[model samples]
Target: MAISSEPRLGASTNGDLVNRVQQLRLDGQLGAGKNSRGGGGALLPWVLCGLLAVTWAGVGVRSYKNAGQKADDTASAPQGTAPAASSTNTPQPAGPSAVAEGELVTQLKGNVIPSLQITVSPRDVAAEITEIFFAEGKRVKRGDKIATLLDHLYVNRLNTEVASVAAAEAQVTRAQASQTSVAAKVAKAKSALAAAEARGTRATAMQERAGKDFDQARQQRASGSIALLDYQRFDADKQAADADKIAATADIEAAKREVEAAEAEVKTAVASTKAATADLGAAKARCAEAQRLVENCVVTAPIDGTILTKSADKGALVSPNSFNVAAGICLIADLSKLEVEIDVPERQITRLKSGQSCKLQADADPTREYRGVVDRVMPIADDTKNVVKVRIRAYLKKGEQQGEFLKPKMSITATVYNTPFTFDPSKDLPWGDEATRK
Candidate 1:
């Protein structure tokens, strides 16, 4: 209702305002309508109250229409859009954000994964699984025998190598003996040379003596004091002595040649000895290598752990590097160590960091909560899922670290609260120091 500031007494209007108010007041429509000259005090209050009442009624009608219109609009609009704001006295609550209820916490879902799972394989050697030493699920110390491959084959190879080494050793002995024999021959040749030289010296002396005798015979014969035959005999004797000296010198040279030949034979024998020694060493090395391979046939536990599975039994053929649940020699794990591995979505990965504490609940026992820490935060991400793999080391309560409460490959939920903290590595110690599994 539009109220006019001035009195509308014009004939063009629906009716005179005073007359209208007078009729409504008589009918009790207005609270009081007595007219007064003093600024129309009685009429003013009544008129104002009537206008206010009309205005509120119109507002109520419009509100009802608007509500219907909103309902229709909402029904016709797309699935998820919110309705327009409504006029209310109180304010609306805010949605979840960084400062959630004045605290910062990040929760993630992950599964329980193995921390010290070991699957023994026959890595480079293809051999038949000949025997299993320990029972499955039994605890074993490091270096303890778990199984044995076909060692008979390797043992045969080792024996053959040993025989070869022995043969090479014999060859080396024969070469040494040959060297000794050549050395003796060289000594004999030297002795013969010395004798030849002595003989040449004696021949030289006899020649000189014969030459003097021949000269004396020639002088006597020429002075007719000796016979010609005697002089001729002395000349013949001198010539024979000269010939013996030449022969002796020749024998000395021949002996020297023989000695040189013997020395050459000695050198060849020494070389042969060295070659045999090298061959023996090589054969022995081959034997040692074969022995090592044979040793590998006996498989041993690499860590103090429990055997989770036995994939291969006696007479089963196992290829090196064969692994998995279907076929393998055995699968072992250190039950003392456990971890929860979860894939944190790329968006939430930023809230997690190494050393952050986490609360864990297994799918098997959701009520029982376990404690753990963020052991690692991978720098890389999985492109397909857009997530990062995080490993959480489980912290067993009291002496439960060595207990069998948790098993590997158990599905579990991990709740991690993002906060700054320190992680102690010593808390995870006392691990199996058993020999590293082969």
Candidate 2:
């Protein structure tokens, strides 16, 4: 029988392909041998047909392997992660979930952020930077000193205020001392007034006795029973006694006036003391204010956090409030309070709420995933983007970090696996069909 020299697609099975190829080689050799030099065209066709047959066999084998490879790729391809038409990356499945089968998830782009990022500034506007206490990126606790500004002026003001307070206190002491002296003068004045009163009483008694003696002498003189000289002498004694009584009365008045003057001095001293005490209090208050301002010059971390940046250096002027500052002293944030800000479509805003579980993947590190929870769902919508902001708190545990990867402002994605599910005991019935289990 003559061997046909034509390529056939279905004529040979894979089991016979090798044998067919061998037979084609033999046939081509026999045909070439039978044909003469002028019959080159006839042998050329068989040789070409044999080559085509071999090529086709190899192609079939390659197709079979390719088919297996495609099947494997399809099997391994995870659910919900289909090759996107516009995307270069075919996103893979995230971490394990507590969610059961058939649960839906919402994926969104987001950025990692610190819960609080505040720029630390000096309370004094004109404060000159003196020293930086902490290096950038160092963690500091609340009340920890981060930097120091020039506090010499405030310190000086405090000193002046303290001196004023001390001076006022000295004045108060002087006033009190004056009050003590006045009190002594008042006591002395009372003693002098008592002495004056005793002297006046003694003078009054002597004057009465002298007046009676003069009256008796005058009566004797009128009766010519005594000499005129004796009567004259008695009159002189009475006049002298009257002068002594008058002098004692004048001394008593003087003593009374002294008492009044001493009492008045005591009043003046008391008023002085009260006024000085008030001045002291006011001075002390000013000193406290100066001290507070001086303390303000020393910049410190207001919260527990790592220093994010430092814009002020030694000798730089710092201020708490300014229309523009080259930058504040520094900015620090609590890294442990790291979260992600996701922009969810306004249409899908209802799909999320607080306490919903989520999966977070950083763009910098995609292979590793971190768990998170929907910390907040902003009710307000951004009209420009038609999106609502959602804040997710990362499930970073306490003590030590599993991985120190999350950082503020890092681009990331949040796969919100927030669908709620409850396992049905009936669905878990053993070795039973769905209808039977129910």
User: In candidate 1, what are the lDDT values of residues 72-116, reduced to their tens digit?
Assistant: 656532223354465688675553224233123455566666677
Every candidate's lDDT: 0.75, 0.77
The segments of candidate 2 whose C-alpha lies over 4 angstroms from its true place after superposition are: 1-106, 203-249, 324-327, 345-351, 378-381, 417-438
Residue range 191-294, candidate 2, lDDT tens digits: 99999999999999999999999999999999999998899999999999999999999999999999999999999999999999999999999999999898
TM-score of each: 0.64, 0.60
Clashing residue pairs in candidate 2 (N, C-alpha, C atoms within 3 angstroms): none
Best by the TM-score measure:
1
Over 4 Å off in model 1, which ranges? Answer: 1-105, 123-125, 201-234, 321-327, 366-369, 401-403, 417-438
lDDT of 1: 0.75
In terms of lDDT, the poorest run of 10 residues in model 2 is 429-438
Clashing pairs in 1: 122-320, 302-436, 302-437
How accurate locally is residue 312 in candidate 1, as Cα lDDT from 0 to 100? 81
